[model samples]
Each structure stands twice: as structure tokens, then as C-alpha cells.
Target: MTPGTRIEHDAFGPVEVPAERYWGAQTQRALAVFTIGTEYFPPCLLHAFGLQKMAAARANLRCGALDAERADAIERAAAELSRGRFDADFPLTIWQTGSGTQTNMNANEVVANRANELLGQPRGGKSPVHPNDHVNASQSSNDSFPTVMHIAATLEIQQRLLPALAVLRDSLADRTQAFRGVVKIARTHLMDAVPMTVDQAFDAFTRQVDLGMERVAGTLPRLRVLPQGGTAAGTGLNAPPGFDTAFCEELSRLTATAFVPNPSKFEGMGVHDALVEASGALNTLASSLIKMANDLRLLGSGPRCGLGELRIPDDGLTSSIMPGKRNPTIAEVLVQAGLQVMGNHVTVTMANASGNFELNVAKPLLIHNLLQSIRVLADAVRVFALRLVAGLELNHERLAANVENALLAVTVLNPVLGYDRVAAIVREALASNRGPREAAVSLGLISAEDYDRHVDAAAMAAPHGLSALRQEPSGTSGRG
Candidate 1:
């Protein structure tokens, strides 16, 4: 053996594992060959692996597949692993195996070794608690890895993503109430269209975020269906009868989350359609977030030269060359994060579709991208809510100015002056560089009193007498 390495034997031959590391022969071999990427599985996934191992051990003990003493040692070691005690022992990157077999084995070996150490045995000695026979009892990398994927995804979405989104939604709802009376010019096709309150725009964003929460929640049912007892190509070949249901029940008790055995373990291991469906939901959310972020960028465009409808919260971020230049840094960051999530959706979609007969060869990549999407998007949303939406201010002066000068408010005058007459008024207003009211007054179109009575910009934002005017036959339809 090498100076600092200890000999561990697998089916292939003797291998030298680092003496200080708890991983065994297979992990050492994987570390040597799969030198590819820097992207390791997230801590949440590792924690999920430990949880799965612990649950499996409990089930195996109940099924009489493991002795009570070994099971006790495994439960202790795995519980510690789940709490992040053995994080350093799991160093394999996501690029190693498609089914995450290497990572699964890595977890097994670590738990076994740790359990042995706790039972007065040396590390790397598979005695009293063989990694596969005990720690991985009634499980295969195929079923267990996918189950871990589901557990990790569900926990992250439930515990992290939804709460962060709710924070943003509540902030937006508060803004909605705050801006209810502040009317502004609305735009369509990048042109001034009519009047709308600032609260209306904020309310629309609140609805989008609410629906995003709903969409993310919609994916949980499918994710909670676990494929754990389908050992070796979804056959349940080596797993004891009733192991699937018992394992899920134990996992649910451990995590306080509802999980059930998949009805068809073959489909669960073979296709990964549930993950694809989840990616679709996330893609929709990304699109909504992008829309909201870009709108913030546009609405808060400039204090002098651009729209200037909304004022962004200044966080001390400024351009290097331009003094006193406060950019919409939070909006920009949010948009970039949303774009990355959208891109991750594409990778997930393709990876899911590439699955072959018995198992998808894209498990590691799919979970990596999905979990990354959840993490970054959740953090960005929290930042957006705290640093941007919570501190957002309306540019009241600009909003009033734009609403006062809006030409499309003349649509409210259509019943008083027919569409053709109103069209001429619009053209004349533009040609003569005059306000619509002024243009109508110059043309002897109507008395200024009537113009003021009919053209209240704030009232035009909601239902007024316009519909009644259009319906009443006694309406003034004059061209003279």
C-alpha cells in the first residue's frame, strides 16, 4: 500500500483508498477516472441521500433483512450524515455517472464505514455493516437515486422556493394597496394607450407571482411519488415485498413530508416524465419572472431621459464612468437569474427525452440543473422583494405629467364626438403640437367646460359614463 493510502478490495481487485477518507474502493476508483467538472451535488441532495439511507436501514430492520445492532449503528451514522457531519467525505462531482450510481455508492460506503467505526470496528472494514448488504438493503442506485432526487427537489421547493415567492408576493400586494389612487399613463405596443393606476400594474404582478406559486405547487404530487423499491432495472428483483410502501412511510415520518410509492416503478425509473413536467412548470415561472423584471427595468428606466414612471431602490450600485448614475441593479440581477433558469429548463427537457429502455442516463445532470434553478431563482426573488419591491417608489410627478398629456384619453370622448371626428382631432393634435383639449378647443369642437367634464384622466382608468354614453341615443355626436 502507498504511504498514506489503505488497501480496500472490491470485486475488481485491491484498491488504495485514502486512509483519512471514509469512502471505499469504488469511490476511490471513480475519483481517479471521472475528472471532469467542478459542479458537485448540492448539500441538500447529499442530505437527502443520508436520509434515504437511514430510512432504508429502518425498513430493512423491520423486514428482518438486517440485525438490530447494525441497524442501530447505521441509523446513528446516517442521521449524522443527514445533518451534514460527513459532507467532506462526499467529493464526487455530478459528471461521474448518469444514474448517480457513484454518488449512491459513495453514500453507502461512507455510512457503512462510519457505522463500523461506531460499532468498535476500523474504517473501511465492511464487517458487521456491509455497505451494500445493510446500508443499501432493498435498494439499487437506479431506484434510490431517483428517490433522492425527488426528496431533494420537493424539500427545496417546499421549504425554500415557495416561502421566498410568498415574501415577494406579499410585498407586491402591499404596493398594490399603496398605489391604488395614483393614476398613470398606460402603454401598449410601446405607445401611450390610455390611463391606468400604478396599483393596477402592481396587482398584475401580484397575480403572476401567485400563479407562479400555484404552478410550483402543482409539481409536488408527481415529485412525491418515489421509486425506491425498484431494485435493478425497476424489477423489484432483490427488494423484499412491501419494502416500497414501508420505505416511503418511514421517509415521510423522518422528513415530515408526504411520500408514496410510485404505482409503476418501471415507468418511474425508465422515463423521468415527472421531472420533465416539473421543468415545464419552472419554465413558465421563469418566463413570468423575466416579464416582471423587464417591466421594472422599463418602468424605472431613467430619472430624466427615459420612462421614469417608477423609481428603483438605490443600493449604491452605480456606473463607474457616470457619477450619480443609479442603475436598476436588482431588476438586472433578477432578469439574469430568470434567464439562467429558462436555459436550465431546456437542458432538463432534452436530458429527460434522452432516456433509454430501463433507466434514464441523465439523472445527475437533470437534478443538478433543477436544484440549481431552484436555489438561484429563490435567492434572486428574495433579493428582488427585499432590495427592490419593498423599497420601490412611484415617480408621482412623472406619472401625473404623462397622464395629463396622454392623447388616447380621447377614446373616452368617442361617444360625444364620433370615431371619425375623434380620429381627426388626434391627427390635428399631433400636427399642431397642441394638447388634445387645446386642439379640440381651437377647432371649435366643444366647449372647454364639456372637455374637462368628459376627459377626466383618472376616471377614464375605470368604468365611467362612457358605456352609458355609447348606448344612449341622445348622446352628442357632433362634427360641427
Candidate 2:
């Protein structure tokens, strides 16, 4: 071995590792074999693995399997790792293996070497702190990796994505209440059909995100159940009696999140159904965000030529050649992000589907995509809310003009005056290029008095009962 490097031996034989690195032969071997991507498992996943190792150490000690001094050193090392220290020690890639055994061993080696260092021993020495027999105790990469996936995913949703979505919901709710009285034209099949308060449009988006939040919440129950105890294959071969229970208890104490062992270790090891369900919820959130962004883009289409009911935020970047063309850059970025999230959901689902019996070989892919979706979706929702939603302006003048000038605005009279009569008025309004009231007056479809009574745009935006329709307006001249 070189003066600054050391040789560590595993089942495969000897490997050279850096003198200062806390990782040993397994991690060094993985580094040499997998050069597929630049993306390593993020620090959160590494932190989760650290937490798992610490929990395992405590569980082993509780079961009288690990001596006090050795357990303390391993626990301290793992505790530091869980807090995200020494993340660089885990250099395995997501594409290394579908089962993520390489990263799992990377964690084991790092903790073991760190524990050895704490005991005043050199790194990679298998003496008092053996990676497998001591640090790993009764756990296997199969069980540990999936457990970390569940823990990491649960924390991400609770700490990042859900809170971000709540902020977005608040922004939309504020917009809805603020625009309650602003009437705007509503369309069906992309054709103007009637008038509706701008508030209703915003309300729909609010409800969509609310339901998405509920969908995201639904995933927690399944995610809370983990496969931490099932060693190599669901058999818990080397795990001590009640070890799984103790591990969960220690994990709950450390994380403050209730994590329970799965009753059916077989199912947990054989499939990632919980992750798939959670991905589906994330997919729903993405779809909701896309719809919301598209709606905003449509509303903020143009200041002079298009819908123009709402003005988009001026991002200070115009077309290089379009002179004064502003763009809905925030909304556009959100929609694209949502699309990537949707596609990531499909990747998770596809990976889950390829699961085989006793051990899911596709676990790494499932978690890689799941974590990515959470991060991307959280950022997208936050940016959309702060940049686009908060900056939106209600173009009241343009909105009122569109509502007042449209012929379909007369359709609200369908229940009051009957469809045939309303249709005749709309036809004349469209043919003459005049407002519905003017068309009614010019066509003599109904007296000017009745036209004024039924053409209340605000009332039409939110229609009422037939009693009001039957009650004739004072000084009515249309009954004749």
C-alpha cells in the first residue's frame, strides 16, 4: 500500500482506499465499477441510512448482543452520520444496483471505520468494530436500504413538499377571496358560454390543490410501515428476537416520527407498493399544478390582444426581437416542472412493477425517482406561488369589458327568458358586432326595460333561484 493510502480486503479480494476516507473496500470497489452517472444518493438518503444504523446499534445493545463500549462507538458514529456529517464517505451511485446494496454497504463501511477511529484505531481495521458483525448487527442491505427509502420519503413529504403546497394553497385562497366580485367571461369548449366571477376560477384551483394535499396525506399510512427487520430475505435470519420492535422504537425516539415495522416482511421485501402509491399522489400534485399554471397562462395570455383578464408578472426579460413582449416565465417553468414530475411518477411505477419475489431488485430506481419528484415538485410549487401567483394583477378594466361586451353573457337569461329568446338575441349580437343589450334594443327581442333587468352581469356570474326570475322588475315594459 502507498504511504497515503491503505488496502482493505472484502470477499472479492483487496482494494486500495484513501488514508483519510472513512469508507473501506466495498465502497472503493463500487467506485471503480459504477461510473454511470454523476448523481450519488443525496445526503438525505445517507442521513436516513445513518439513522437506521444507529437504531440497529441500539436495538443490538438492548438485546444484549453488542458490548457497551463497541455499541457506544458505533452509535456515536452513526449519530453523526444521521445528522449529515461524512456524507461524502458514501460515494455509490443510484445506478449501481437495483437493490442499492452498494450504498448500503458504503454506509456500513463508513460507520465501522468511523467507529474504529473513535476507539483510537486506524480506519479499515476489522478489529473491535467489524462492519457486518458489529455495526450491521442483524440487518441486511435489502432491509436497511428500503427502510431508509421509507424514512427519507416520509420526512421529505412532511418537511418540504407538503409545507410548500400549503403555502401555495394560501396564496391561491387569498387570490380567490380578493377577486370575489370581479366578473369575467367563462368559456366551455374554448368558446365563451357565460359569465362567472373571477373568484370561482381561483376557487376551483384552490380546491384542486386542497384535494392534492389530501392525496399526499393518504400516502403516510402506508409509508409508516417499514421493512427494517427483514434481513437478507424476509426471514430475519440473524436478527435477534424482538430486534425489529426495538429498532422501530429507537428510530421513533430519534426521529420523532412514528415508524413501525411491517407485519408482512415478505410483501415489503417483494414489492414497493407503498412507494408507488406515494408517487401516484405526487403525480396528482403535478397534474394539479399543471392545470393551475395553464389556467394562469391562459388568463394572462396578452395585455392587448388575448384574454388579458389578468396581467402576468413582468420578469424583466422580453423577447430579444419582439420589442416589448413580456412573458409568463414563471408559469411556463412550472408547467415544464410538472411535466417532469409526471414522467418521474411513471418511472417509479415502472420500477415497482418489475419487482420480483422475496426481494425487489428495482428499489433504487423507485427511490431515486421518488426523491427527485418530491424535490422538483416542492420547488416548482414554491416558485409558482411566490413569483407568479403573488404578483398577478387583476385587469379589472379588461375583465369588465370582456364580460360586458360578449353576446354569450346573454345565456344567463336562458333560465329567466328561455333559451329560444336568449339564443335569438345572442345571434343578433354576434351578427351585428354589438353588445347583447344593444342587440336586444335594436332587434326589439325584448323591451329595453327587460333587457336591463336580465342583463345584470354580476347576477348572471352567480345565478339564483326561479323565484327571482318570476318576480317581475318594477316598471317592466317587456310583458307585452
Candidate 3:
């Protein structure tokens, strides 16, 4: 211990704490007990904690339970924490007590110590702003931690993840419109199928993002309900009357997000099912992103011997061994991000299931994994939009050539000609290394003039009425 450090005592006994630190006994104990990973909650969550403390102080003051001076000191201290000035003070790991009681106490101690300082008291002096009596007035770890969980998760989604997804969606929509006329071969089961515009492919990707955004939006209503008033066991015990309503009102005002007291506070405390449901939505988004990124990688596979359809910018990254070789850096980045989020949902679901009795013990890990997925996904989506998807280049000549040489282009003739005849033509085109149109002509299945009109890539791409080369060859009536 440092020479200037002071010893603080709690139920467990005395422990030496650094003199410059704002946290007290409980926080110091937790810091020493959980010497696990360095993965702490982000600043946003800590800010949410500070904001919750501030709202509680205001609510307690408004309800006449707390005096003005103590409330003002706690409120000022909370505002500073909410502004993220004390993020370093919270060095506790994510792998802590299941109910996150230790972290809750960490917040309580920081707020109390800082509040005392605001009143000209020495650091660690919990006089006017007692950690539990004032800073954590009218609340418990069971209630306050869950309340901040919802608030932090909600804001992170609305302000960070959704906007990043919107940018990616817009980028895809732009490409869809820009490439509307560029026709390319469609692939099914990794085999050539038919002709479709490049825009059609991008349009599908845009719809995936749209649906992902909607799924995430669906979780907001449930998240807006808070369990802050139901301290200890959802009974609102020891809390002043009307405190719940006031706390919610003050919280809503402070966050600009409407929050109501949970009618069934027991359910909120007993099960983190709401978070599990939100994780499901995030998982769906990760799946969609992986599919889209994989598609981009396939499209941008090769500028020489592969698809050669789309070009992926390598973000200035080049292969060390093979100079001038650019990999699909952003696509790989999104794929790995998706994998992590997919894994995170499982952890959240399992943790939610492990909650016993009145309080779920998995609170710390739940919020940790949830915020981890959101922040990583948001950053990856933004990078994909601006650095990769928005700058994608199309190989128009390659696309046109692939569409021309497509053997399955004859599949369109199946509607007019019999399937057997079209199959024969497909085989002959592949074997003879001739275009489908030329095969159809040489096989005497259609006249050159009629083949020219019917088998055109663009014409077959969107056919209004069924018509074949040579108008259903004489004596060979269509199956339909």
C-alpha cells in the first residue's frame, strides 16, 4: 500500500485503499476479490449508472425523504460521473457478483465520496452523503442495476447501433439503384441459374438490413419500463410513497427517454428475459450481416479467375507475400464480428436462464455481453458502409460476358419449349462450348431471328408474355 493511502473498514474488515481514489470499502474489496479479466463495462453503462443515481437523488428530494443539501451534493457528483469524468474510478471486472451488487456498491461509494468532496469534506468521508443512506437512497442493487441495464442498452441501440445499420442500408440501397441496369448471371446451389439485374441482388441485401432494424426496434417498448422503485424484492420496501413515479419521471427527463415503473417488478428482477429477447434480435441481425458479407466476398472473389463481378476495397491492406493482392478486409471483419455476436446471444440466453428466486445472478455478464455485441457490431457496420460497401465497383464487362455465356440461359425456353429439348440444348451448349442461343439455332430448335428476340438476357430477365424462338416449333406443342 502507498504511504499516503488510508484504511477503510466494512463488514469484511479493514483494507488499505489508495488516497487519491474516490471509491471506498465495498469497491476496494470487490476489486481485490475479482481478479479476473480486465473487461469492465464501457463508459456508456457507467454514465447510465451515474444518471440513475442523479435521478434517484432528485426523486428522493422531491418526495421529501432527503434534505436539499445532501441531494444537491449527490446530484452534482452524479452529474460528473454521468459526464464520464470518473470512468477510471470504476476498474472492477465484468466477472463479479452475479446480481452486480459489487458494481452497484462501487457506484454508491464513488457518488458518496465525490458528493462529500463537493461539500468541502475530505475524500472517503461519507458524512453528509452516506454511500447507502444518501447516494443509494430509496434503491437497492436488485432494482438500480436492472434499471440502468435497460437504460444503457436502450440508448446504445437507439443512438449507436441503429444509426450505423441505417448507414449500411443506405449504402446498399444506393448500389441497388446504381446497378439496376447491369445484368448478371444468377447462381443457385453454386451453379448457373438465370439472368437478374445487379440491382436485384443489392435490393435483397437492403431488405435484410431493413428487417434487422425493425426487429431491434421491436424491443424498445419493453426496455422503456424500469424496475428502479422495487428495491430489494419488488415490494418497494422502505422507499417513500410516490418514489417510483418520481424516479421514473426524473429519469425520463434526464435521459430524454420515457421510462415507466414496471408493473410486475418481480418478473423484471427474477428474469432477464427482456434482455434475452433483445439478444435474439441482435442474433438475427448478425446472421443477416454474415450472409451479406459472405455474398460480397463471393462477388468480389477475384478480379482475374473468379466471379470478377464486384470489387472489394482492401482498406489499404495488401498481402505481404503476394504484392498487389488485396483481400476483402471489411467483409472478413463483419464476418468475424457476426460470429462474436452470435456467440454472445448464447451467453445471454444461458445467463438469463440461470437466475434463481427473486434476483437474477447473471446481471453483470448479461449487460457485458449485450454491450459488447452492440458496440462491435455498430463499429463494424459503420466501417462496412463507408469503407467498403459504398465504394464497391462493378465489373460491367465481366457481368455481361458471364450472362452471355450462361448455359442455363436456356432455362427460360423451358416455358415455351419442352424441358427435354431445353435440357438437350444445355448439354450441347456446354459440350460444344457454344452459347445457348447458337446451340438453339444449330440444333434447329429455333430460327436465328426468333432466337434473337426471345433469348435476350434483358428480355428473359423480365418477361411479360411467354414466347419462344420460332413460336413453339411446328408439331411440337408446348407442355402448357
Candidate 4:
């Protein structure tokens, strides 16, 4: 026998497992076979496995599939696992089986060994509580893994992602209200076009975040529909009748989240459309974050040479060569995170599409990508809001400078001077490198007093002189 290991038997043969660990033969086999990646399933998914195992044990007990003694032991062990007590025992990597069967067996073995220890038996013997027959009663890896995926993802979105998004949205909303009267030059095609309030820009960002929350929330109903009763295949071969409903009820009670059995176990087991839909929503949210982050970076680009319309908060990260230069580190982090979420969505979509007849063979990769996307996005959004958006300061001098220098503000005088006259004044101003007022006065098109009175930059930002502009001939539309 190996000095630091003990012998544990499965259908293959006696296998050597670490003496101090609780996992048995199948887990040890998985550890040796799947040496591909350093990534393991996240703690959330592990906790979800625990919760599902516990709920399944209780449902089995209610259905007369397991005796009270074994069921109680499993429930206790699984509840501990749910609370992260046996985290070390779950050592399988996410790269193991496509069905995540090895991880499921890993959980079963851990729960069984721990339950046996609670019953005053040795850990590796699988006595008094066999890993498969007792600990995993009325369940199969096929059904259990997907159930855990749904549970973990739903909890993550509800507890982490949604709250972070709400906080970000609220922060932007506060900015919108705070800067309502602050006007700045608005650009289209990277050229100054007209004037717009800072609040209007912030309002658009806030609405994007708000709509992202709604989009994510819209996918929850599909996630709550689980396929726990489909064991081995979608035939409910080993699971008891009503086990799906009973398990969902128990799981809902334990998690305080509503869950229901899928109307068709075959469909649920065969495809991951719910997860795909959820990922699509997350992708949409990531796109919005990308746009917001890019806008913030541009708006806060420079204090000396760039836009400089808004001042980004100092994140304590400076450029290596540029002394005393503060970069938009937080916005950059958010943008990178959003980009990663987009890439992970692509992986998830491909993984979900790999489902074969009665089971999707890409279960582990799908859940792993989805969970990673959720975790990174939640963290980035929260930090971006708290560290950057809340501390953003407007550069009033810069806003005024940009607004006063913008030639598009001359469009407001179109109704008074006519298009050709305004066009001539704009061309003269640009050609002479002088202000539009000077150009108009020199061109004898208007006096400086009349130009100032007609060209109200801030008033042009909203509906001003709309009636006069619309009073043109019925067939003639005003030109900018």
C-alpha cells in the first residue's frame, strides 16, 4: 500500500486515495485523468451541489427510497458541504467529464465518507452510507449537475449581479440629477454638432444600466425550471415518482427561492436553452457596460490635451513613465471586464450548442463560463460605480469653452438669418480663425448684439424657437 494513501474500491478495482481526504475511488480516478486545467468549479457551484444533494436526500426520504438513518446522515453531511465545511474534499477540476459526472461523484463520495464518519465508521469503506446507493439516492449526475448549475447561476444573478447593477444605475441617476443644468458641446462623428446637457449623457447611461437589469431578470423564469427527476437518461429510471416536484419544493424551502419541475424532462436534459438565453442577456449588459466605459474614458481622457470635459477619480495607479499622471484605471478595468464577459458569452454559446440527443456534453464548460461572466461583471460594475462614477467631477471651464467655441451653435440663428447667410458667416469665421459673432458682424449679415441675442447655445440644446423654425413654407424643411 502507498504510505500516505489508502485503498478504496469502485467498479474498476481497488484505488489508492489520499489517507486524509474524504473522496473515494471515482474522484481519485478523475484527479489522475483530467489534468488539463487549473480551474475548478467555483465555490458557488460547489455550494449548489451541496444544496441539491441535501434536497434530493430529503425528497428520497419522503418517497420511501431511503431510510431515515442514512437520509439524516446524508442531510447533515450535505448541509455542512453546502455551508462550505468540506470544501477541501471537492478537488475535481472543471475539465473532468462533459456531464460533470466526476464532480458529482466527488460530492457523493465526500458526503458518504463524512456521513459514515458521523456513524462511527471508517471514511473510505463506503459502509453504512454507500456513495452511490445512499448518499446519491434518487439522483444521477446528468440531472444533478444541471440542477446545480441553475441553482448557482440564479442565486448569483439575484444576490450579486442585480444588486451591483442597481447601485451603478442609481449612482448614474444621481449624476444625472446633479448635472441637469450643466451644458457641454455634444459630438457626432467625432465632430462638434450641437450643445447638450451633461445630465442628458448621464441619463442615457443610467437607462442602459436599468434596461440591462430588466433584460437579466427576464431570463429567471426559465432558469427556475429544473430537471431533477431525469436520472441516467430522461426516463426517470431510478428516481421515484413526484421526486422532481418534491425536490424543487425542498430546494425552494432551503434557498428561499422558487423552483419548479420542468414540464418535459427530455427537453430540459437534451438542451440548455435557458442558460443560453441568460447568457444572451448578460452579453447585452456587457455591451452596455462597454459603451459606458468607453464614453467615460473619452470624456475623462485628459486634463491638458484631450476632451477634459469630466475629471476621473484617481485610482492610485499611475503611468510607469509619466510622473504624476493619473490614468482612467477604473474605467479601463470595467471595459476589460466587459470585454471578457463578451468573450465568455461566445464560449457559452458554443458550449450550449454542443448538446447531443438526450444530454448536452458541454455542461461543465457552459456553467463555468456563465459563472465567471457573472462574477467578474458584478465585481467590475460595483467597483466602477463606487470608485469612479460617484466621484466624477465636471470641468465647468472646459464645458463652457467647448460650448462657446462650437460653430454649430450658429444653427440657432438659421431661423433669423436664413441658411445661406448663416453658412457664409460660418465659412468666414472658420476661414479667419475668429469667432462667429465677429464673422457675422464683418460680413454685414448682423450686428454683434443681434448675433448674441439670436445664438443662445444653451437654449438651442432644448426646444427653443421651435415654432419659428417650423413656420417656414410648408414644403421647405430647415437645414442645419
The lDDT of model 3 is: 0.89
* lDDT for position 119 in model 3: 95
Q: Residue 108: error of model 4 in Å?
A: 0.8
lDDT for each residue of candidate 1 in 112-133, tens digit (9 for 90 to 100): 9999999999987799889888
Off by over 4 Å in 3: 463-480
Candidate 4 residue lDDT tens string, 90-115: 88778977898999999999999999
Each model's TM-score, in the order given?
0.97, 0.95, 0.96, 0.95
lDDT of residue 274 for candidate 4: 96
Q: Which portions of model 4 show Cα errors greater than 4 Å?
A: 463-480
Q: lDDT (CA) for every model shown?
A: 0.90, 0.86, 0.89, 0.90
Reference-based lDDT, residue 415, model 3: 62
Can you write out model 2's per-residue Cα lDDT over 1-480, one digit (the tens) per residue? Answer: 778899898998988899889899988888888988877677888888888999999999999889999999999999999998898777777888778989888888999998998999988887789998898889898898899999999999999999999989999999998888888888889888677889999999999989999999899989989898899899899998999899999999988989899998888888999999999998888888898899899888877788888987888889989998899988888899889889999999999888787888988888988998898889889988888887778998998788778788676566555678777888888788878898877877677786677677787767552325644454443332
Off by over 4 Å in 1: 463-465, 469-475
Instruction: For candidate 2, list the clashing residue pairs, or say none.
Output: none
Local error of candidate 4 at residue 170 (angstroms): 1.2
**Model 4, residue pairs in steric clash:** none
| Model 4 lDDT on a 0 to 1 scale | 0.90
Q: Candidate 2: where are CA atoms >4 Å away?
A: 320-324, 463-480
In model 2, the worst 10-residue window by lDDT is 471-480
